[model samples]
Target: MVPIFVIAGIAIGMAAFVLLIQMAVRNGIRMSGLIDWRTQYELERIDDADGGKPTLHELYEIAAKTDSAPDAIERNVRAKALDYIESRNSIHVRNCWIVIGVAVGVCFLAMIITLASSPM
Candidate 1:
């Protein structure tokens, strides 16, 4: 029926929107961590002479070599950075779950509507 098709179309569109929002949130969380890590570690200076930035693995190696056993200031900064990153990640994950829940609910509603409107 037309109503069932309309409901399904709307549900599909909303599900796609929810997925896009989840992806954006996930990417934003990752990018925020990357930016914070780069700033905290002065990763710009770790680049090759040809101006190529180091890969994440290389950056980890550099950090391992340089950042052993935190001093007082370093310890405080590390703790704060970790707290910020964790909070951001948690918030993003929560939002993603909400979107996923909505998508699933929409699909369920569409299915119910479709079945109810169909002839036996």
Candidate 2:
């Protein structure tokens, strides 16, 4: 009976987390594609309704370069700039995912330990 309650609580918590993510997504959409994935804030590029134009590349895609570089990122071709942004953004996104994975793993481990140790 205790295990049943514990499982039900976990389910409810997970459902709440899903709901929170959905709310974040809705809010971001309402606010210029700005999303905070509980780890960091990232801008999501949304193209125009007709698929003719995307949001300005400068809005979301900032070129990553060293401070010592003499070359102006602005001089680079649009494609190259976009590529650099994608790579940089991917690094942030990958870290976010890893953090999420670690969190979930820790939670799972805690749950197992709690259940195993419980006399009920």
lDDT of 1 at 70: 43
Candidate 2 ranges beyond 4 A from true positions: 1-75
Best by TM-score: 1
How would you encode candidate 1's per-residue C-alpha lDDT over 5-107 as one tens digit per residue?
7667686867668686767765575656556653533333332244444444564555567677546445545554455445555655776777667767776
Ten contiguous residues with the weakest lDDT in model 1: 40-49
> Which is the leading candidate under lDDT?
1
| Cα distance off (Å), candidate 1, residue 111 | 0.9
Candidate 2, 1-120: lDDT as tens digits: 656756765765576567556645544453432433211222323311233333444422344332233254444434443553455456545544655565476557657766886887
Quantify how close model 2 is to the true structure by its C-alpha RMSD in Å.
11.4
Global lDDT for candidate 1? 0.59
